[model samples]
Target: MILEIAQLQVKPEQSADFEAAFAQAQRIIAAMPGYLGHELQRCVEQAGHYMLLVRWRTLDDHQVGFRQSAQYQEWRALLHHFYDPFPTVLHYEQVAL
Candidate 1:
């Protein structure tokens, strides 16, 4: 499985709106193919920072299957404006401990 981590920096005073939008946006991603699960974590110390962790069956499932789909555009529209700059998304595979 692949884990996609997005570091999101939302605009100041927009956390409420961002979270509200994300509530709707999360459903869009959850319905996509290869979607395993996800979590949205808000930083206690930093009011406008968040961590979004998404699990996928494969890298392409997220990078290609989801990002390239029309649903992505909806996802973008629902939550993109709240971002100050933009979220940085990175994917990782579990390593043996």
Candidate 2:
């Protein structure tokens, strides 16, 4: 499986709003084909920071399948603007576990 780890640094006072928007946003992603599962986490050290951990059947499932789908637009509309300086999303694969 391909694992995607997205780190989001939200604006100071926008955390609550961002989370609310993401509640709807997650449903869109979860409906997409090839979606395995995901977890969302808030950073303890950085209050406004968040992380999205998702697993896919393959890299293309995320880079192409999900991103190209219309649901992604809704996801972006809801969550993209809440980002402060934007975030870097990286993907990896299981090596040992």
Candidate 3:
């Protein structure tokens, strides 16, 4: 499985709107192929910061299957505007240890 982590820093006054938009946007990602589950977490000290964790069956399932699909455009439209400088997303695999 692959784990996608995005560190999002939303615009200062737009956190509420961002969360509302994300509520709708989450459905789009959940419907994609190889999607397992996801979580959107807000930072306690940083008012406008959030972390998004998504689970997929493979890296391509997220990078190629989802990001390259039309649904990604919809996802981008719904949530991209709230980001401050854009988030950097990274993927990881579980370590046996």
| Alpha carbon lDDT of each predicted model | 0.95, 0.91, 0.97
For model 2, what is the C-alpha lDDT against the true structure?
Answer: 0.91
Alpha carbon RMSD to native, model 2? 0.7
How many backbone clashes are present in model 1?
A: 0
Candidate 1 global CA lDDT score: 0.95
Compare candidates 2 and 3 on lDDT and give the better one: 3
Instruction: Point out where model 3 deviates above 4 Å.
Output: none
Model 2, 14-54: lDDT tens digits are 99999899898989889888899999999889979999999
- Model 1: ten consecutive residues of lowest lDDT: 82-91
RMSD of 1: 0.8
**CA-only RMSD, every prediction:** 0.8, 0.7, 0.8
Best by TM-score: 3
Alpha carbon lDDT of residue 39, candidate 3? Answer: 100
Name the top lDDT candidate: 3
lDDT of 1 by residue, 1-97 (tens): 9999999999969899999999999999999999999999999998799999999999999989999999999999999999888888999999985
In model 1, the runs with Cα more than 4 Å from the true position are none
